[model samples]
Target: MSSASAQPANEPDNVFRDPAFRHFWFARLCTTIGYQILTVAVGWQMYALTNDAFMLGMVGLVQFLPSIVLLLMSGHVADRFDRRIIVRTCQMVEALIAVAMAVASFSGWITSEYIFLFVALLGGTRAFETPTLQALLPSVVTPRQLPRAVALASSATQAAIIIGPALGGFAYVAGPGVVYTISAVLFSIAALMVFTLKLRQAPQRLTAPVSVKTLFAGFAYIRSNPVLLGAISLDLFAVLLGGATALLPIYAKDILHTGPWGLGLLRSSPAIGALVTALWLARNPLNRRVGRVMFGAVAIFGVATMVFGISTWLPLSMAALVVLGASDMISVVVRSTLVQLDTPDDMRGRVGAVNSVFIGASNQLGEFESGVTAALLGPVGAVLLGGFGTLCVVAAWMKLFPMLTNRDQLHDHSAHGSGKAATAR
Candidate 1:
């Protein structure tokens, strides 16, 4: 039997079967679900308290700003220390923040200001956690399976995105306080799961402590690598313009004319599409013409966003969002796999940190952009313009970053089992 045919149909044989990867995946899912639930609860609390659109925008800005500021330092810490320990510590901090939010909510002390503070704290943790997690994944799986592993991870996260908000909305109707308490419990459980994982320690460099020199080295690496720089920039610019998540409440309230339940569905539509695509990728890894596929997918995402912006019908908007989600997932998987496949192990943390900065900037900056645009042009105009802008970015990036367009030709150097190639600094 062929290798693919020999695999169990139910199992869909992939790198996910690795015990360590499975443990990591499950832990990630638990934390993500909790975080999503907390997000919805906080948004509900903020809306109930201030009822101001600008304040909502401010909440997102507060979180992203801190994350961008701290991301580089966090990456240095990840490289200088044991990544397993860093991840566990971050997870514990996340659990504590979740607990604190729950307590604040249950005690009738919840306010928009409090939510902002809490979110900022969580964002700080994420700045550290994201780099470490991204850097750590390759350690748990072989290079040949990196793409599959990434797809599985993305799918798991998207699954949480789909389920978490839906659950949060239902919980919110019961009470934001109750939702927060449940989120807290879930976070605690996720932390405990991280604590139980047996992770390999990254070799410590026999060099001076982390300093400005070390920080700049990461930047230098990015500046020197055209392919890496290109992939990162494509994602950064495209998502920075295309992301409309921050303005969803406006759409739900003004455009869709639905309440909290409708808002949840709108929030989840993309995740539903992403989850399905990720599962397919996990089962059938893409090994050919990945670059062309990525470009086409992102262009489709832009078109879908444009369609979504013009649609007033809830179902039609949701359909557009689904396409947007699926196309975005393709871009995400392609870019992420490229990063992992090319990065040296010693530099993974710093590189991942750089990626986090782009991610943080894109998401937070996107929120800021959406808020300002919506304030000036109204929500519909803002979304339509944003989508159109994303299409232009796609074209610009294709011309500017030829490496991304030729991504399929790139090889996974990490698969050769040569520690020298895999761990080169």
Candidate 2:
């Protein structure tokens, strides 16, 4: 996966020209859609079963628990085994789980406990699949196409994020069993595609015995590099503080003088913005001052959050959300490119796993933070404070992580390894 791997003369410049990439991309789309649909269907089923808000919350808890519990071990497994097989296995298992859920739903035997058990199982498989897939991407395409691939991947995810829930909700009308059956089919398709992927060369699987040091090696590697640490942590803090989406319901209903329709628009605005940005970047890759650009994007994210927080007008609020989404996409592309290009082939899984955890923590914890702060300070006050905190984090991070601020190119990461923290080792 080195940058020096020459693209074959017969190879086309476009990422889609590679059959492997096309298969990989389509597979990702299917799995994301299936999982998102599962999420919506499961939430609906859980609430209907228990009629309890706590059980509804438990659905999310069951999913998050697996990532925290298995992340280190899963990272170790990803690095040691063939990533394609790992991903394929996870997909297959998820498909089986979907089948079971479908059967139960149709049989009138699906209980809240049954749903929770399977959901946790699905979450566990994803913990393994996610990091492995991140590691697998560089091998599917050349280093030259990695950034474009990352952008395309982002687009697939964003599109699925929007499509999955909507489709699930629509299909649920036909019956919960119909939604579950569709999910099973989609997961099976993804599993088949993942198994078919051929890496440029066979990976040299790690045969070393497992140990505490080996399990946590990803953290050690990240800590060894300031740029890597900065890029990864910057995202964590920025999103943690600037997350205003959790408060969108309040704004849409109370402040903006609108209804569920307004809330839907508010929610979709940022995702729509992100999807467009991802498509744009896929065609026009970031080639210069990526670090500065990432920071700048984050700064704009903070600003947009603040603007959205205080704005009373619906259009103004939606506008701010769109800008916020666009800026977040830029940072995502930068961080993804940096991680893939900067790390070694063998270590990609471990690094990717740690990266996944940071992302998960930022998202899960950020929502909690928003809820608590919103309760204490009120919705507008919470959002405004979060945005201001994001700006402060940017300033502090710029001064603290000089390596990230001064970083120049995504492809030339290896060339700029003058600092002790330059390479993950």
Candidate 3:
């Protein structure tokens, strides 16, 4: 029998069988859960305390500033240092921040300013951790297994995102302190799992001394690669304009007339759709029409966002969010796979840093934008405008980056040659 035929239908391939990757997957699940819980808890508490739309947006800004400020240093650190250690150290810092949040909430000292301060610290931890974690993935799995690995990893995270928010919302009924304490415990568990992993990494060989030029190598590399730039930029601008998550708390309370549990359900709805799609992708990975699929998925995301923006009923809003999450997952997997496949191993760390920065801008800066827009236009108007803006971005990107739109098949590196070649010119 052929090797493919010999593999049992019920069993996962060797990628799932790998012990190290399994542990890493579990660690990611735990970490995602912790972070999601923290997000729900903080967002709810911040809105409750200040009742100001802009202040809620400032919450995102505070978390975002640290990552951008340390972007270069973060990439360099991941490249030069032991990545496992870097990830673990960052997790420890996050755990401490969670602890501080718990104490603050319990004492009734958790003002918006204090929440912003703690979240800022958590963002600093994320700045160092994200690139290292991204770079570390290749060490755990073989190149051939990477697509499945990415899918499984994404599924794990989506599962956590689905569960964490609902649990946090219920815990919020008891108090923010309870939700924070759970986050602290989960963070510590994730750290311990990372510590236990025996990663297969090549010895670090720094060929060049650290300098201004060396630090900015990621930017230069990305600039020279139009495919990479186009892919990242598409996601950055589309989501930046389309995101309505920061205003969710307001929607749940004022627009939808839902309580804390309803808020949790709202948060989890997207992840539920994402998790379902992720699991299916893990079993049957995408190989053909990769670029077209990404573009189509993003367009769906924009349409769904508009639907959710206008929705007054809970079920309609939740359904829209579900579609929104499902569409975004396709873009996430494609962009991540492309970035990982194209970059040289030595430069992956720095490239991962650049990727993280783009993500932060889309998510964090996007939240700030939502807040400002909500203040000016009201929540419904802000989200509607964002969704329309996202569609325009997609059209513009299609015209500007024809390479991305015309591209076929994701697994083939040769298809990306035009983008890379365009960069060198």
Candidate 4:
């Protein structure tokens, strides 16, 4: 089917204004906030147990390594099943994991090893859930509303990132156990909300038997498509080099001379900035010069990272982080819209899974990079050098993928035969 043909005529005129979308959006927001709480709680607890930066990296490693291993299989599963059910199942698993952690923490049985195990389980569930969620978005609204939906999703996530850490920090001061318990409760609520959503399923294709060859097709697609490869690489390099979140505890305790509350603010500053920009973009979508905007935003992100690295004042550092967040959000929306528009529906699951791996790698690998660099060069030097490194990557990518740089408008040309790409200039 042609991209235009994919638009369901029965779709409500006010799809973007649909109540179901709002419920879905709120569920995602709640889950993200809970995830943030768990992240901070685990990191703080791990540091208190073992002061090694490498161990901090280990936390991220455990979460992402399994994701890398299982992503292709996860994609296959999503393609063959109901996405909503997949999402609900994964959320339920996540809720159980949260409950386990809460029990461990509250009962004084929580340990670094237990946390690692919990993170690993969470990663496995995410391997299945992430692709399903991404693939489900187009089903929730018409193609014309996708840009708005994407913006709303991004803003909601950033909002969670903004509030989660602050709430986690406060909860931590009261007790780590309390934070874990609260996260569990929130996760349960999110799962319940997801259960209440009424999404129409897309028609499935009858395909040839699945095999290892089919499994690797997603990787082959990514390797062969310049645009997809370029976008993923851009994200990986920028985030891997510029990610400073992993080292926030060090700065909070040793550098900034701040309490848990201040640490929360510092951690959340970027997301707050991102949320502001995302909300604006939601109101006024970026319909032109997307390529230039993406590149410029990423460059600005690098610059902000550099500034944040050197700033001793809390307010200046927070301001720098805000800029970084805003810049990152711009890149996020541009790349995501491009990817979704370019991908074929039959291949959405596998392609989205591959994208998830890139995201996982960028975040977890970035955490590892930050921890190791901080250990080797001290926090200031590590962050400053990382910012410079990100700039270098962006410059190189811009040179290598000139097509991405010069692209004047989004197109839906398929690079594969699975089906027609579902958007156009």
Q: Give the top-scoring candidate (TM-score).
A: 2
For model 2, name the residue pairs that clash. none
Candidate-wise lDDT, in order: 0.79, 0.88, 0.84, 0.80
Report the error of model 3 at residue 134, Å: 1.4
Candidates' RMSD to native: 3.8, 2.6, 3.9, 4.1
Q: Candidate 3 at 176: error in angstroms? A: 4.5
**Which residue ranges in model 4 land beyond 4 Å of their true spot?**
1-16, 44-56, 105-111, 172-177, 200-206, 247-262, 374-378, 411-425
For model 1, the run of ten residues with the poorest summed lDDT: 414-423
- State candidate 2's TM-score: 0.95
Per the 3 Å backbone cut-off, how many clashing residue pairs does candidate 2 have?
A: 0
Rank candidates by TM-score, best first.
Answer: 2, 1, 4, 3
TM-scores for every candidate against the unseen true structure: 0.87, 0.95, 0.85, 0.87
Writing each residue's lDDT as its tens digit, candidate 3 over 1-425 gives 58546645544467778888888898888888999999999999999998986787687778889989999999888888888888888888899999999999899877888898899999999998888888888788765567778888899889887788778878899999999999999989989989998765563433578888778888987877766788999999988999887789999999999998788778878888898888888878887788788888999999999999999999999999999999999889888877877766566678899999998778877887898999999999999999999889888888888877877766565744543453333
Please estimate how well model 3 matches the true structure, expressed as its whole-model Cα lDDT: 0.84
- For model 2, how does the per-residue alpha-carbon lDDT over 316-382 read when each residue is reduced to its tens digit? 9999999999999999999998887777767778889999989988987898899999999999999
Give the distance in Å from residue 68's predicted Cα in candidate 4 to where it truly belongs: 1.6
Residue 267's lDDT in candidate 4: 80
- Model 1: pairs clashing at backbone N, Cα or C within 3 Å: none
